[model samples]
Target chain A: MTDWQAFFIALLQGATELFPVSSLGHAVVVPALLHWAFRQADPSFVPFLTLLHLGTATALVILYWRDWLGIVKGFVRGAVRGRIEAENERLAMLLLAGTIPGGLIGFLLERPLKALFATPRVAALFLILNGAILLTAEALRRRSERRDLSREEQEQQFKSAQQITFKAAFVTGGAQALALLPGISRSGVTICGGLLAGLRHQEAARFSFLLATPIIAAAGLLEVPQLFSQRGPLALYAAAAVVAGLAAYISARFLIRYFRAGRLDPYGWYCAAFGLLALILLR
Target chain B: METRGNPALAGVVAALGALFVIISALYAFGAVSFATSDPGAAHHYKHALVALAIAVACLVAANVVRPKAA
Candidate 1:
């Protein structure tokens, strides 16, 4: 691929990765639609994609540095003392629970699923289904009393990520599991699961962002060595990674604010329309 | 100003998605090509007619599902 193509892919990776839309779906469909030849079977493809994800994960870490600091401190202190801090223990465990399903599923089924639905046509179909998932989730009447909260109150409730039950995390993680599909989005499913579990949108969004960091890191770490072994342009890829990071960071900021009072319905429309176009044109 | 924010912004996004569909269609049908080295390069997209129709329906559904301001 050309430098500009790599840059464009990185930009899309950064933005869509966080936007509760399927970045994987975009990764598949966009190239096919543009008639850009990307060999998914090529050994280098996953590494290239992982580098872009590293950029995304970096953005998440930077954005939530304070939260990460607390989670780490609390985790380390508890590990040494054998008595986890009440809030940190709960939050950390919930994140662990939320990570489990996707991790297991990716480990076992990723190869098979990619073999079956990695094609742009199949990914596009799943993308439309993803739209339906977002809309249906949004349409469910919120059960939490936190509905109609102002921005500041919402922030307070966000701290209640500590209060998330293990069941909630498991279910949300189950949603993340579906993201092994090319068009299924990890953040979209987790956030939808979060909302259904009675967390407000911002809360769900925050947790989704948190949930993404480890998964992205693990995937990137596995493939980054391959990137160096390959003949790809290091400077161009680095520039693309930076572009991806910036795009993800900005998109996350916008989304955090938007979810304050905004609905996921617009994204639903977006996914449906784009997926339709994909289904029509792509094989 | 209708699209500076909020409900208007939502519609604008939907519209832009539709525009992309249109552009994609143009590319698929050889109405346009970005093959700079060979401008006349022809690209074939599967099911061009069906794609065109879906592109139109996408625009409709996008607007139909748009949330009203307020």
Candidate 2:
């Protein structure tokens, strides 16, 4: 792999990974569409992918540093006392609850799903479905009392992410497990789950990002051993991780603003159009 | 809490992303090269670099053309 190729991959990884669009979908589609000589099943490639996820998770942490710090400190305190009263403690538990479903699904079915559905054709098809899912979620959210909020109303709407029930978070995480498929998005599904649980757009999005961080980081953590054992693109992989982290921070900033006043309609349209074009071209 | 939209931040990011594209393109066009004492290693390295340049070019175009989140 070349320096630029790594940069390119990391760029996509950063931009799409958390944007309610499927990074896995893009990973499958872009390389095939461009006819790169890259091989996904290669031993080195898996580690590279893990590092990309790590980069994104790092971006999430960097952007939400204070929130994470408070959560960590509160969780330690709560664990010691065997009680949870503060907002951070409640939120930390919610995030943990939200991680279980997707993590379990990924652990159980990742290899088979990748084997069966890694093709551009399958990914493109799922991308179309993912579009429909987003549109449906947006429509449902709009019909409710808890639609997208204004900057001022946002503060009044939910006191904290802790306002959401632990059961709701778990269900949302379970919904995220659908992302085991290449084009089924963890963020989109979880955000939709949040919407259904009566959170506004920004609230849902915040929960989605928080819910995603640990899963993304844990994925990379598990693969760290493989990275050490593998002999490929060490320096390039590191660069890709850095570039991906930079892009993800910027993308995350844009997305948080976008969700406040915007619907997921644009992403829905993009997924639909791009998926259709890929289907046509690949056909 | 990046609550409000900021055009300046968007522009800055776009410019930075564009820079990556240009630099990658230059590398692809052979504006950059590496030297090695071993002929075979050098040949392989050069080939890989050129291929990477091409790949990056495609990615940069795709990234630039894609819609922004906002």
Fnat computed for model 1: 0.00
Error of 2 at A147 (Å): 9.6
The residue pairs that clash in candidate 2, if any, are: none
Would you list the C-alpha lDDT of every candidate in the order shown? Answer: 0.73, 0.73
Compute the lDDT of residue A21 as modeled in candidate 2. Answer: 81
Model 2 alpha-carbon drift over 4 Å, by segment: A146-160, B1-70
lDDT of 2 at A14: 91
lDDT of 1 by residue, B1-70 (tens): 0111234633764665476577667767678644222347575342233234334433432343345343
> Worst ten-residue run, lDDT, model 1 chain A?
A76-85
Report candidate 2's fraction of native contacts. 0.00
| lDDT (tens digit, per residue) of candidate 1 on A1-283 | 9988989999999999999789989988898899987755457675677678788889889999998887777655543443334676556557755765566466446666777788888888898899999999987733343668774574355434666766788689767878989888889998888887777788889899988888887677656766866877777777888899999999999999998767788888889999998898864
Worst 10 residues of 2 chain B by lDDT: B34-43
TM-scores for all candidates: the values are 0.75, 0.76
lDDT of 2 by residue, B13-61 (tens): 3454455455445444555332211233323332233233334323332
